[model samples]
Target: MDLPQSQLVAAHVQECNFVQIIEGLVDSSHLGFLHIDTLRKSDSSDLAYAQNVNSMQHALAPKIGVEDTAFGFYYAALRDIRKEGESRLQARVAGFIAPFTVLNPNGDLHQLVIPMTDTRSMFIHVYSASRRRSTRSRYAVSTCGWWAWTARHCSDFT
Candidate 1:
């Protein structure tokens, strides 16, 4: 017998009242700058996690394309990739589920940004990718734990 599809493998609810978090989610331009210490990495034996940053895709102003979908809105961030005489557009697509849900392209990650009170918000994150469970879990743990441990030192955003 086959089982039904599960959209949510794990859900984590966190308090992140920063109104700018949503903006940070939608903006690819900050990927290189703000998350210079975080974001982007895989299983690499030689390279340390702290030494890896997806610089190629960071600080890039992607050609944004948006369409009103039945569910809500569909947006694509197109990055230019060229080699020799060849040209291509690498796309990262995301779907906004009306009020606050966002289905991200990678790791089957979905985020729901809900405002609870002034200066307080709940970020509901759901991850569905089961194949790369360990990698995803490590990344999530590093991001949450490491960021929390070092957030106090980050003063540029304010």
Candidate 2:
């Protein structure tokens, strides 16, 4: 059977599919690096470039909370798993996501772990469309790079 649409329409459709695949691949590729630094170390990948903590200490550390607040406060609290250490370490996470649009899912932007079941797990992500002030502050190199990758994919998601 002969098609009525022009060749340009077919080309456009293919282009759109290509873009979606690229975006999806980028999303999935982020999982390994974002979830853990283990893969990066074994592969000698630059993905494990966190500057603030040494690998040995990081391995022993319990958990770290990264937080940003409406009062223009942002910080990270490092908890010691051993509980033997009295001091807690902390730092401010860079950049702010505008309100009503990109605020953290649980009044916070991200969470490392949430248990859904005995074996299965769930991770929830919340994104908004509201606009807010941009500080133009210098963000960490890794953060900036991820933002750049996401920005490109945002055209499809947004």
Candidate 3:
């Protein structure tokens, strides 16, 4: 909740409906499958991100649990993790804020899918980290790569 340090990355997707983007955001099941290459290449040194990707990779099918809230709803993708010969359950929870905002399971990431037109949308990714820990370098590299990829493939969607 306390995000003193923040960065925003926005991408324009042509010929894509905002609702479609939101649906994709809320579907945790596709993360490992869709981004398997990225996940497989994740650096183990990158604690948080790597751990999340590892969990996702190990559990392709997670049990989904949803709960309604006044603003919108929150959902959890429950996965199994094995460590030290012991098995445990890991729950990755994310929330759908009313309108078009989504609170990612990481807690620091928030996404907004805004409609620019009936067939176009602006996808904004907000990375908000605590002041105690700086994510400047990581954020910069990630956004730069994302922008480059978007620039190269954006036309495909049109």
Number of the predicted model whose TM-score against the real structure is largest: 3
Per residue, candidate 3 scores C-alpha lDDT tens digits across 1-158 of 44334454544343467777787778888888888877777745466756665767777899999999999999989999775688889898889998999998877778888787876676667776542243334322232243212222222233
User: Could you give candidate 2's per-residue lDDT for residues 67-131 as a string of tens digits?
Assistant: 55674333333333232565544332332333212222123233222233332222223322222
Candidate 3's C-alpha runs over 4 A off are: 1-15, 130-149, 152-158
Clash tally, candidates in order = 0, 5, 0
RMSD versus native structure for model 1: 6.7
Q: Give the per-residue Cα lDDT of candidate 3 at 97.
A: 94
Instruction: Please list the residue runs of candidate 1 whose C-alpha ends up more than 4 Å from where it truly belongs after superposition.
Output: 1-15, 37-59, 83-86, 132-158
Q: Which candidate would rank higher by lDDT, 1 or 2?
A: 1
State the TM-score for model 2.
0.24
lDDT of each: 0.53, 0.29, 0.69
Per-residue lDDT tens digits for candidate 1, residues 13-114, read 334554555666655556655554454442232333222224323426677888898888877777775545676666767777777877765536677777
How far off is residue 14 in model 1, in Å? 4.8
In model 2, how large is the Cα lDDT of residue 56? Answer: 26
**2 versus 3: better TM-score goes to:** 3
RMSD of 3: 5.7
